[model samples]
Target: MKRIGKWKDRLAAYVDGTSGEKLDQGVICRDDQCTLGKWIYGEGLAQTGNLPTFHQVKAKHAEFHVNAGQVVEAVQSGHQDNAHKMLHEGSFAKSSRDV
Candidate 1:
């Protein structure tokens, strides 16, 4: 995955529940399909297989100001090891206030 800079804003809108029509814009992928949308809507993975792991996903959520419910959803849907890593070593672990 590219640096988190690209899809940051779109993911923020998604977690904020204020995406509105921007929800149609999707994540920034080579095929223009929305990776986050697939996860949020349970739409299954895109053909490209460029899925972000739980740590990366949650880190971006924190970095972009995502909400608590979205964070919980990420943990529920994420890989166990990735979620563990985020809980133990990533931003999610550091920001007790956010949790």
Candidate 2:
């Protein structure tokens, strides 16, 4: 227990990196596919998988959209968004006060 806690504290970045699968390209929602609003309002979910997906799947989909979108945007613009959505309930979204 102590060792696990220590690992969590000492290697936050490294630990998070290994938790998700990498992809060559990210899925972007278009037209009927985008659902950031539904996710934020808790009306739906957003999850990702190894295979290609068009819309939100589970609660994690929103996070995947954010993460994948950031990756795509960064690769193209050389910058990443402040929020990184890797998995479901991975990290709380930054509050307005935090910004």
Each candidate structure's count of clashing pairs: 0, 5
Kindly list the per-residue Cα lDDT of model 1 for residues 1-99, writing each as its tens digit.
342433433444444445553332112221212454445334333433355664454444444333322333454465445544543455434443332
Off by over 4 Å in 2: 1-57, 79-99
Q: What overall lDDT goes with each candidate model?
A: 0.40, 0.35
Location of the lowest summed lDDT over 10 successive residues in candidate 2: 90-99
After superposing candidate 1 on the true structure, give the runs of residues whose Cα lies further than 4 Å from its correct spot.
1-71, 97-99
What is the alpha-carbon lDDT of model 1 when measured against the actual structure? Answer: 0.40
Model 2 per-residue lDDT tens digits across residues 21-97: 33333443221244444543444323433324434333344444454444444434533232233211233222111
